[model samples]
Target: MFYPLRERISTWTTSQQTAEEETELIQRKRIQDLPLLRAAKENDIHLLKQLLEDKNCDPFQRGAVGETALHVAVQHENLEAAEILLDEAPQLINQPMTSDLYQGEHILTFAACVGDIEIVKILLDHGANLHAKDSWGNTILHILVLQPSKSLLCQMLDFLLSKDGGKTLIDIPNARGLTPLKMAASEGNVTMFQHLIQKKRKIQWTYGPAATMMYDISECDSMEDHKSVLELIATSSKSQAHKILNVPPVKELLQKKWQNVGRPYTWFLTAVYILYMICVSLCCAHRPLKPREDNVTNQRDITIYVQKTLKEAYLSGDDRLRLVGEIISVVGAFILLLSELSQAYIFGLKYFISHNFWRDPFNIIRICYSCMILVILGMRLTDADGEVVPMSAALVLGWCYIMYFARGFQMLGPFTIIIRKMAASDLLKFCWLMAVVVCGYSLALYVTFQTVDPQALGAFYSYTMTLISTYCLFSNLLNGPANYTIDNPAMYSPLYSSFCVIAFLLMFNLLIAMMGDTQSAMAKKKEELWKAEISGATVKMEQTFPKSHWFCSESSGNDFKETRYISLEEKKWHPFHLEEASGSSSDDESDEDVPPQNSQERNPNLDPYQEIREDITDRAEDRGNVDHNDNEIWEEELFEF
Candidate 1:
């Protein structure tokens, strides 16, 4: 097989880096022979205890693998050996690996990754650091996501969260800047993503007026996983995405950011779009007059076609208004076209297509309007006069697309969303049904009556004419089907009546019912749905023009400060800080900076961790959930261990 030059160079570079790292790890590690570590690796419980009994033996010493005996025991799943090693040297429980493969990873992380709850519990009980991170800054929860068994992973997460200070571990970012929740989202693990998000019960008031949540929007600034969470959920299921967006913390965060950053940009775009619309209207209204075909032209002939060039229109003082309008319209259309292309560039072509950008009614209208303006200018330049249809279309689309801009306003935003929802869903489905019915009925009626009464059908006895007649007859069904009376009592007459009954009475009623249901369902979540729209809008702005580009980048109210003050009631969430909240005499100025504790402080009643654990437990209740008997055996052995 052949490889590209770039691929070869990349592979060589990665290999070289790996080799250098391994060489460095080997140099730093003490690769001396150690019988205690060896005994643990071989699960020799008797030898491990005998070696630990020796006064000179260092049970805490790392062997060639740069891991203490506890790490080796955990790695090899030597439960008895691990317990003996821990008993010999409790400090070995938190000893980090210096080897290249597991560099910076502690013994407890190794035990967690080993998928043995007993070993994990034993290590944690021995005072292993819960906040330990590997070389990639991955916490125990982060490493657990890599395990194949989601059920076991969820179970482990629940167990860990039940421990002290585990909530803090949920949002801790890795070296690549991905939290466990974000990593799950990036990997397209819907269940894990949902579980991670719903389990986050942390909420605190920042030093400033702003509030903070476990899921920080600021952390999503990295280009690699900027939109990974939202994009994954949206692509997987729109309803799920909406639900996530509507979550109280997520919605509040988005709302605050929009007020600080997104509102200004959105207002600017609204102004520009408004200008484009005005320009379009002016160009359509003040068209350049055509030349007089006859010596004495009537009033109607003067506005027939815009046949004059810009220079000619300018020279003819009477038509100079049209020239100015065209110039402005052309500029506006070019600007709008660039904006449209920018969306494609920002989202990338694959995402833009997969998300069905073109299917959006607003995008379709805006695109058609912009393209039509350019087309009209091209036609004018090429002397293709009397082009009424394109100009009329541009006018209609330009004004109608105001609904897209209307999304920025609170009052009109939900109404526009409801309209868009119906148009995209019910209207589209209705149109497809109408096309099928019209085409099918038109063909059936055309074939049925053509051979029997060719002349009665008329001289234009074609499918196109038949389709038109059938469409017109659909309207006449309200008037009691008067055309059926004129027709002879025949088979075709009954067929026409049946077509009217099915297409008009049945399909039309179904469309009405669908629209009503959609409206009613959406009405319940109107405010939430509106917030979701605003959140989506802000997210787009955030991705396109990041905070780094903001001129007023002052970090006060705009910035979400890391230091947040938790109330006494909510102090259980920060189990480590309960003593601090207890008014201990500490000289920390940051703690003094916290506002006076509020008596009305409230704690979250819902325990998402417990709920998710129950859900996972119920799903994995039966052995039949596993595909293979081997899986059951593996799970059972691991759990029992």
Candidate 2:
């Protein structure tokens, strides 16, 4: 009996050891599956398949996180593994294995949050509910919309919209009591906001408590809150406000800043006026009666005498004062030209007057002084001593006329084209014309001095000679072994004169070529203008009449049917040319209908006149109503934050 008990005890110990070994083996198997589950969770499909091929592997088995292979595959967006798992075991897709492990996050919620549209589609295809919500009470659509990718959001939104009972998706609120529209507005997702608006329009959704609360908060007393509400409304509407908001407010602010800074041109005109007045006052103070024999030796003394004599003639009652006026003008002109060409006082005088022109009467006085410069040039050229040159009066006048006319053509030709292109309004054109006249007078004085004495030409003559020499050199440099000769009357060379004639012909040819180019540019510009008019008119006509009136019969029954056909054809072929001409005519009419306003007619203190006037009136009335006691109430309270 004792031997039998010992054998039974040994068998019991052996069985106990085998049971412990089996448990150890099971534990080893469980530990080995950890990496495999991790690989599955990371969407490493090859490693997962290898782990599944292990003889110890159970496909239905849960990991430490209670996430089965199928749940892991779906959560990681491994669509291939999901397909395989579904094929192998179709029951795992809907199984909520990780609800207890991952703070109640289901597999579908993970897929939606990650924006795995294909995985989400697969789950839906395999009998996953479209309206499935996570532990946070957030729908799959809500999670998908929150993903950063706009394209993914659009895809998910489209999918939800196409599904049965999908209209209620926008109505579903999160834990924050904010609907999808409010969330989209708050997040500033413009495209999502537009999508929501379109959905609301199609479904005719009534504004719920959440939308009403947002509206109420928008009207709160704080400026910050008011601004936030305006932004929210502007974002949510998907209307004109959205387009306007996209255009930066800083652009308007910069424009206002520039206006307040004032105009450089105005300051320039003012300085000119002041210098002119100073010169006039000095001339009036020292009026001279006659020219002196020593005037040639001291030109400044002659200039002062001539200026004084002109002032005397201007104030005199004698008829002979007109002839005296002419003589004074002639002397004054010669002096001014000499001054300009010699560059004697040009730089110094310009620097002196530069500071004074902008003040009051100086601006106007400077403009009048500019007129004197040209008058001086003409008089000097016409009144040179006949005895010195032995030229007749008519001959002198003819030369003067030719020189002045050619000078005017040279100055005015380019200026006219430039001014025409630059000035958009008639008033601006008039201002530019006056500016050109002033500039022309100053240039005449410069030219008169230049032609009379080559030595007196200064930098202006040097620059001209340099430019001509450079052009000749460049031509020689570009085309080797070419002869280019310039005129030198001092040398008395016939060859120089012949070369000059050839150069003149070549220059004339160039001028002709330039004119041709200008003509072509003008023609092109005209064609562009016509095309613009045609396009504008066509758009107006189309807007005036419906699409049906363009091609369809007027009869009610036939018009509807014909419009569909016409619209179909239009979609196929746009035919912009056919519509352009009519559009242009309509545009012309509209342009003509709008009356133009002058600067004087517009209120200087206000821009966007109607709104500014209303704001001013309201503020004035409010100020009038306020008493002394109200001032205390109006004072802002300082808050310590």
Candidate 3:
């Protein structure tokens, strides 16, 4: 074929390759050599030896990732192959990988990164330079600081410091202007944070505030995580708190301010929700005669045909209003769900998990309200032309949504606060006791009524209904609708009377006493309760969302500026001991002068280790229960949101 003329720029490309280099390049490009590379990575001595004997094979040739056979071995932590490669060509120790993950990363850097102590020892013994900076400007110390397995990170850091003696690597800043200390602070590693503070605290306040240290506060996962960042910045920093706060511009995001518009907005939602519910109520007023017809039969075919036609006519013609209401409810629910998701995204997912969705009681209520509507949507999708479950869902949603305004208004907040405290305390215990007693009595009545009055109270559901109806009498939700408490007095008289005595006279009165004790206890802390309610109400208002994103998105306080502070290393300051907690255990005091980085592991025999393990176990058990006497059981309350 006659080829067209193409632009030839040999000067811009590498057209001057030697015969041996050209062959090696071809070998490097072949996918067939992947098995050879894999063998080297797996440290298969026999296969690797065979590959090494082939002169045409370039053992040190780069792959598509710009990694050599030796790099693969070190990356895979194959000490055997790495040793053989080092023996063959020691110069490869300083060669950098061109891969993005390990750009300009030498052998010792990768070894220190993976915490392969053996390979690190070998490379270090071969005069591998510890002073070399990688693409991230991290020394061995910075690479190891954030590792979850602190033992290896700790060991490498301690070893490197001991060798350097001056610890110059400790304060070296990266391209992002983040020193090892600041990066450690953002991780919320209390032990690492405290260790870094102890190592570098001698620097004076004249260095200005270290706002960069706590830059990750918005993304923190737990309240304790946020507190850890603040503790390091506010309590540990030698700089004044006001000056230190200057870095991140995060104070506005932290403090949720009250907006009066939230109340009106909530009422608007209430109106729309109520309108949709009213339509649903009209639909439910008339139901198909043969509703919930899972299993049914009739003797006369004509009679069956007539019944089916009447049922279909009733459902298809009259339930149009209900379908419209359901559609509107679904739309409203969808909008609320989207609003919740957007708000959560803006606040940061971890922060939303810790504070808004999990901790805020009203937020949980709103989520539950939306979920009930979702269930109604699913039921409608299933073409459930029934009235019972949908009606029950609407009733529950109406009351649950009140939680939003209940927390928002100033007057209602106090009442809700008392209810919350009662719920958190006495109501929780009482509900458990009530459920157990109800279930026990329900089973007994089921057997008793089956024998005496099989028609009225024959089914298990009948006994359950009567027991629940009598139970509701205690809450004043029902007065005297015990199905047969009056009609079949012989069957229901003893059950009703006994239930009243046990549930109302005993359990119900005990609940009131518990509530009184809780109320009295809360009354002693009314001032604190008022303060918390005020803060919660403000959060509720802020959560209403602004008509414009200008305040949140355009404000200068929304983000940090790109600025770097000078490190204290210029003045050559050294770290000293922090004040130990008083009444410290002998083990703690003994280890005071010793940096925590020096201790690879805690003493298993010590009470501190035992106590921490026990605490974790206890918290796990408490999380499995609904009650929250001591543990943070409320964290698990929102099963889904």
Candidate 1 residue spans exceeding 4 A from truth: 1-117, 123-139, 143-177, 181-252, 289-315, 356-359, 447-461, 472-492, 542-641
Which runs of model 2 end up more than 4 angstroms from their true locations? 1-68, 95-102, 203-641
Q: Report the CA-based lDDT of candidate 1 relative to the real structure.
A: 0.67
Q: In candidate 3, residue 97 scores what lDDT?
A: 72
Candidate 3 or 2, higher lDDT: 3
TM-score of 3: 0.38
**On residues 1-641, what C-alpha lDDT tens digit does candidate 3 reach at each position?**
21322334443244545544665565455424676577766789788777777787676777666777777788889999888777776777877778643577677767876878888888877778877777877765666665777656666665665556455776676665556655665443444544554443222112212212222232211122223233333222232222222222223222322233334554555676667666545544543345343445654333221112323533564556555656676676677677778868887888887656654455665566567677755654566544356557756665666654554455666666677768766777898897888777676666656655544543344766656754566565766444536265365567668777887789978998999987887666554344344433334433355436213332212222321112222232445445443434456557566556412255544554555455445544543211233223223321221
Task: Give the candidate number with the greatest TM-score.
Answer: 1
Question: lDDT tens string, model 1, 96-145?
Answer: 88975568878777877777889889988888888888888888888887
Candidates 1 and 3, the one with greater TM-score: 1
Q: Using Cα atoms with residue i matched to residue i, what is each candidate's TM-score against the true structure?
A: 0.56, 0.28, 0.38
TM-score of 2: 0.28
| CA shift of 185, model 1, Å | 7.7
Better of 1 and 2 by TM-score: 1
Distance from true location, Cα of 612 in model 2, Å: 43
